[model samples]
Target chain A: MKFKNNTVTLDATDLKILEALQKDARQTYTAIGKSLGMAHSTVYDRIKRMERQGIIKKYTTVIDAEKAGAKIITAIMTVFTDPKESENVAKKLCLAPQILEVYTSLSEELLIIAKVIAENQEGLHEFIACSVAPLPGVLRIRTSMITKKFKETQFSIADNSKVNIYKRNP
Target chain B: MNEKMASRILRTLSREKAFYFFTSIGNYTGESAASLRTFVDKIREMNLKSLEFHFYRGDFEKWIAEVLEDKELAEQIGTFRNSSPIGESLKNELYRILVRRYSKLKSMLY
Candidate 1:
């Protein structure tokens, strides 16, 4: 664990710890220490340090929606909005429970991209026709349904290797 | 238990028939045990979430009974599940049950 002002560089041990937590977030420090053959207090300190540095982000429980009886269809909706009202429309989209993610594109296009979920095809149709189409943006909408998700995982130790976080001053 | 039945119960299972621990649907802890020994080792190491999840779902007993072909151990786990012990207790007690029966079964092999 090597971190300075605004520079957080995790060593191999830290990455291994992160991997263990990613696999099972609820694992206690003692259990993690036993698994990795490290001290529990040391593990605790590392996790706390990562949390303070905003590297660890947050811990959350991942629910299986389909297994929980909520097998909703996911769609990536690209709503082209009036440049002035794009922010407004994006904020409004955040209010709906069906919207899983909402992001106002910062690129040239006045677009509000959102990851939306619906009960079924009919539900999605109703959502687009009733809720989205009537928005004040007053522009066309393009939706790309996500029929199959090949990979959907938060960037972890495995995915962060390509990042230059490990690179430091010469 | 009889010697023949004990042998069947104590016999090693294939990798395909191994039990996997899942805290929730699609949430795999990456902990799996192919045999009774490995199952005990996993039970000891498995996170509390997975322990509670499988205990409540009766998955432990189902695997033990069906895959391992240890009806007696399965019945023990089944009875234990019926008791509805909490997370830590479930792990400790379940481990005890499995270890006890496993030792007895091993002894019967000779």
Candidate 2:
């Protein structure tokens, strides 16, 4: 059914396609069809439509940094800005390898978060020392190491009250 | 394995505590033991109280150096760096373990 804010209507099959892609974007249309009991072309078309609608984004592999022998370090940085310098500072922070995500708070706090995997303690130290600490506009940084993983999931398409498009198409 | 070896490990870690255990684990075998011990030391030193471990790709040093060293890989690295977060629930588990250890020590002192 259509979203309340937007008039776009998506069916059960569309939901299934979105769910599958969310879990593993690299999943082939043939594979998705087998899971959903649909033809391969149908799945392909739905995915294309989803992309055109701006619902589904790009696909890539998720790696395990610890297994890859990269030391993972995280830091939540706070920055004080003249507001105009915010974009330039964010651009610089975005380029650092250690930084994973940057969030600009409505309270005007620039939250810069990062993760880094290094070969050894020395490597990790150098990465932080040279790469991250040098970024402009960073006023403070609270660094921590990730010792475990909890929840990771793709988008869920279950918000719709009812899905009845399959019958109409059949 | 004998109970002696197991007891030996527990005792060494218990006696040494923070810095001692980290030093001892360098020569320790077993992936779980080595990594766990090192992680424990970090927790004690940083006073994090909680932590979580997750697997992610890309090297921090390699990515930064690649940006400076090679431009194409830099773009690919940029995309990878944009998404990755280890949440609070996992961190709390590690915190519980550390707090339990600290409490046990406090009991021993009094």
Candidate 3:
């Protein structure tokens, strides 16, 4: 099977390798080769090719926030500003350490959902008031504390299934 | 989808200067705990600058019984719930034991 993304075409073996690494990046090339019934060198070569193609950006470690002693807060912020100012405001929000995830909503309103972490409620408030709220074009910021996390996982190749490959006529 | 959610949570945690732990064990059951347990165990190994535990008033024991469905585990956690709203020591001890248990179980399977 050939998985094509724009101009890049990845074979079945490549997809399998990506899936394996997505599960555990620390898995040795030998271990991955054994599982996939390929040689260690083959696994190495495939990974190298994928990296060069920019499919695999970087390896990262995942940490648990609650166990580490920080409070998790999720906020849905709606920025009431000029259409031209939206991009600037989003860029500014990205620079703050406390602002975790920020993405624009599909609706007309410039809505952004951000995940923030702080030592406590007071620290969270301070971050929003002093740092985030003051950014140009940021009109209002509403935050809600994340009381519990039911499920969480790192990025995996499985998500690629949702991508639409068919092109539509303009 | 699950991995994305976990990644977002991890990214949020990584940027913090202080360490904090939060888990809603009651929302998960057997297999779902795998990723959560792995993440918790990994962070525990890191030498963080500061460590704290955050929780709702009585969520600790509630999670054990309702989510894990383990009466014994809930009883063990209940002993720690006797204190205040945010019991740092209790949370730390409970997490340590849980992480150890999960790690041991995982090793046995492999």
Candidate 4:
């Protein structure tokens, strides 16, 4: 949609574009522009604006985490650190390249989750044992192998009716 | 909706006789935190009361902690850490309320 000063405003079209891009970030801007019935430059400008607004995060190549020799392991490591050590422990975990994401729990239980992609299972084990386990204040670590991937995807606006049990508005 | 009714709703949805819907939360083919928020917003707009999710993208515990300020929505969605997907229960009373408020699904349900 058109906006003031040639700046674009987000309308249903923009939302549709966002939804479509989120589903497949690799889609060309030209393709998106064609589908949206807008000029390629207009679409590019709108996307740039959205990125500046932190709405459209960076586009990523969906590499097969497994084929990349990196496994997306989910670990619920219970961090038993003092309240003061929380920040340090979190920082340590965050700094590890293997640890993609980390977050804390409301309760005393500090949840440590990561996607440990190593050269092999032994390498992954060594990283966890020497680097991760040796870290102070880590009370217990529980690891669950991703036996089968049922489904996985980033946030997108699309057919959520099947996803959400609740009935949604059109 | 209480747990039993929620379970019924899930069972009904899973039957997939007339409609088939599927969603999951993982780094691969499931919903993300932002997508979940959007879905919740849309469902709430339709005034849906009952919903269920199998959260496995990242750490549920951390996700829950981040949104403690939104206790109402958190309670509605129900978060579990290190728990199996099969154990989550449905809130059926909420479903009844949603059913009454969002009649649009009536046509879709059949």
Residue A131 in candidate 2, Cα distance off native in Å? 3.9
Model 2, position A1, has a per-residue lDDT of: 39
Considering just chain B, what TM-score does every model have? 0.91, 0.27, 0.40, 0.25
- Give the per-residue Cα lDDT of candidate 1 at A68: 90
TM-score of 3: 0.53
User: What is the DockQ score, from 0 to 1, of model 2?
Assistant: 0.02
DockQ of each candidate relative to the true complex: 0.01, 0.02, 0.01, 0.01
For residue A107, model 1's alpha carbon misses the true position, in angstroms, by 5.4
TM-score of 2: 0.45
- Candidates 2 and 4 compared: the better one by TM-score is 4
- lDDT of predicted model 3: 0.55
Interface RMSD of 4: 14.9
**How well does each candidate reproduce the native contacts, as fnat?**
0.00, 0.00, 0.00, 0.00
Off by over 4 Å in 3: A1-7, A69-80, A159-170, B1-110
The digit string of per-residue lDDT tens for model 2 on B4-93 reads: 422332332221121211111111111111222344445434321222211133322243233223233334434434544345433344
Over 4 Å off, model 2: A1-9, A24-31, A71-82, A107-110, A116-129, A153-170, B1-110
lDDT of 1 at B68: 80
Candidate 3 per-residue lDDT, tens place, B1-110, comes to: 24443243223221122222222211111111223354455444422211222233344344445443434545655665554424445446757766664454445443
lDDT of 4 by residue, B5-101 (tens): 3333323211112111113111111112232223333333321111233233222222333432323334433433233333213233333333442
Q: lDDT of candidate 2 vs native? A: 0.47
What is candidate 3's CA lDDT for residue A8?
A: 67
**Model 3 chain A: which ten-residue window has the lowest total lDDT?**
A161-170
